[model samples]
Target: MLAFFIYGCDSNNKIWEVFQEKDLLKHPYASRCGDCHQDIYNQWKNSRHAKAYISEDYKKATHNYSKTKCLNCHIPLELSKGEKPQIRNFHKEDGVNCVSCHFSSQTNSMHGPYDVFSPPHPSTKDEDFRKAFICSSCHQETYKQWKKAKVEKTCQQCHMTPVEKKDLIQKFPFHWFHLAKEVYNHEFKTGKIKDLKVKVKKEGNTLLLTITNNQIPHNFPTADNGKPKVYVFVETFKNDKKIEEDNALITPKFAFIYNKPKILEFNFFEDFDKVKVVIYRKLSWQKKKEKITEKIFNFK
Candidate 1:
């Protein structure tokens, strides 16, 4: 195979020196990009995206990869804005790797939120890279809910929390040429979940707990193709002694809609003087539930 690149530099144009079209679309691999973007690669390596195809939970759910539809998203070959991705045969182990999300056949270049001249590959400045549609293909429902909420925050703003400015690349020569810009964490964490708005009201022997998905603009505990659950645990006490404990479950079918409230009721004797409520969420892909927010109420 012949390595091909047109070599020239004048601060305005950079002919491909290290990457040819075949190196990108035909022989795709994340490590090739990691040659320069070491920091970003390390962050992505530890993310759920890195394990999308290899996750035990995903494999178990798919019955050892028997479900073909599940494979596409888990080991997507490429991603197009507002469209579901197509599965690739090679590098399936990489799961949702760099090329899956960044490289576009449409543009025949890597798309990002910045404009830059690079010797290794072709780069295109794309506004869609900063928008929610970039994630809409995989996060269908959440994207829909986000649109309904009509907030200004994109999914990246929340999940890909911004980090301090630094060289986008780690290579010495390349690192010095590019200006530092706000870098987004490639780990893809949702960060600290905003606390939900909750209130407890007592009407004598009747107790009501209302939970509102405040501040968040999407459905709480939402998922695209998997079932996610939200649990509301309630406890009642009379003079500091817990007398009753119960819970209500909320699912994606009836998820905590954007700004709407879901009320749960507990009927007890009029003697109860205090109440405690705790919320937990079990995402579709997780085996354990984690506590989200909790509140206590006292009536003297």
Candidate 2:
């Protein structure tokens, strides 16, 4: 799971000294990395990881940043080698930055999925960087669901799939010349509707709808806060007139218990000539429900 990259250092080696500073906040911002890693930094700047602290949705959910508990993951000191992290006061606005994942206090060095000669700053190769456990501290519920599913793909494999890139870093005097390597995408796209296996059926007076997280390793609509929801809308029409409509909302708390098939049942009248079922999901921070899938049934 580990990947390697060469690092070139200047004779003075001022970067290593800064990395050893007690105040990690003093560490360079992601923008600074852009000087050398323009593409990667731009990708990170537009990601949720970059907006973890300053996002309006997060602010609303935490009641204007009053909840100290909610702030921990958004501004963690450093992710523990095992799980969880200690909160830090500095660099609150930076959210989950590069150093948060790369810097290791134990070894006092930058840790990544690489073991290369990085004399600019001490770098360690950590296989955990490529595993899902590294994300478990903040994504506790999703990690539990993934473990239950027993999927082979790690979080990084799915969310941070690798892409071929020629320039991993900008041209620097002492930097090693790298051809092309598979660098992980920092977009972190999750909660895709296409990943779910959904089926709807009519049995007697009950409309049974089944949903399975076929592709996603974690629970559907998973979140630590902001109240994500899954809506199941059912409607019956008689002679082109709407007869009955029923809907159900599945929240994060209940979605976590979705180890088994999420079968939603709705009782309906037999007179209906047609029935329609629609499923939609809204992220905790989203304002509108995005359609996942829908079905229509006709009765003779």
Candidate 3:
């Protein structure tokens, strides 16, 4: 393997050789990786992973960087190490960049789900990149919930849907020779309430509503920090006149159960002719709850 020394000066003005790997010397920054993998970089640029350190909500919640505990995950180093990575002083703003998950200290190479013949950087295929436990250190609560649910589908399979692409790299010497392949999208979108199943029924003077996390493997609002909530509102009407309304908030806390139905019951007047149930969700960092869906039933 070819190796070279890359010299750079830190804040202290002392020169340091950060990498002895030959290819790494050319691409030290995540932005440099974008030179070839433009599409993946753009997708990551719009994801929560990219804004982990710079998000306004996260900054406000951490009390303007007073909470050191939140820094580890926000500006993580090598995640493949299976430990809480130290916050990087250099490029701290990048937040969970391509190197965070792909870099391997042991092999001193980029680790990925696929074996790639990259001339710009040394790479190795690691199976751990395909597993969910790889994310447990950062997403502890969600990982536990997924484990309890005992589902076979991995986190990447659902969040990073695969697509057919012609080239993984751009402007390379072997670019034209490479064929199309299936690659996963890097957006990493989460928290979809569209697949949830809601059932409502009236029994005597009480209305029962069941909300099931049918498509998700974990809880509806799953996270390690921040208070994500699911709101259930019930309104009763009699003869076109508004009578009474009630609402319940479902907040997933530590040790919250996943992949189960949350049943809510509302008691209404016997003469009530109509009932309306509305579901709303608020992300932990969001200022307001957004309506997901609503159901109206007539008992008259």
Best by TM-score: 1
* Clashes in predicted model 1: 0
| lDDT string, candidate 1, 1-300, tens digits | 121122224433434443343576554777878888999999999898888888887888999989998877888877866777898878888989999988888877788999876656777898988998999888888999999998999999988988999888998666655678888999998654558888888998788888888777788878887777989888889989999888889888888888898888888764688888888888766789999888889988
Error of 3 at 179 (Å): 2.9
Checking candidate 3 for backbone clashes, the offending pairs are: none
- Per residue, candidate 3 scores C-alpha lDDT tens digits across 1-300 of 111221122212323222223656332567777877777888889888888888888888989979988888888877735467777666878988888777767777788877665555567888877888788878887888898889899898888888776577665543543455667788887746674576878787788887777777887778777678878888888887888898987887621255577678888766577888888888766788898888888877
Q: What are the runs in model 3 whose C-alpha is more than 4 Å off?
A: 1-27, 201-205, 254-257, 267-271
| Best candidate (score: lDDT) | 1
Residue 31 in model 3: lDDT: 75
Instruction: Give model 1's TM-score versus the native structure.
Output: 0.90
List where candidate 2 sits over 4 angstroms from the true fold.
Answer: 1-26, 174-176, 239-241, 256-259
Residues 1-300, candidate 2: write the lDDT tens digits.
112322345424665564343443345677765666677787788788889999998888788999998877888888875566788687778898888777877787778786554434566889898899999888877888889888788989888888775456664632454445567887776636564566767777777777775666677777766678988888988887888999999887777243467888889766577788788899866789999878777874
Q: Please give the distance, in angstroms, between residue 130's alpha carbon in candidate 1 and its true position after superposition.
A: 0.8
Clashes of each: 0, 0, 0
The better candidate by lDDT, 1 or 2, is 1
Off by over 4 Å in 1: 1-22
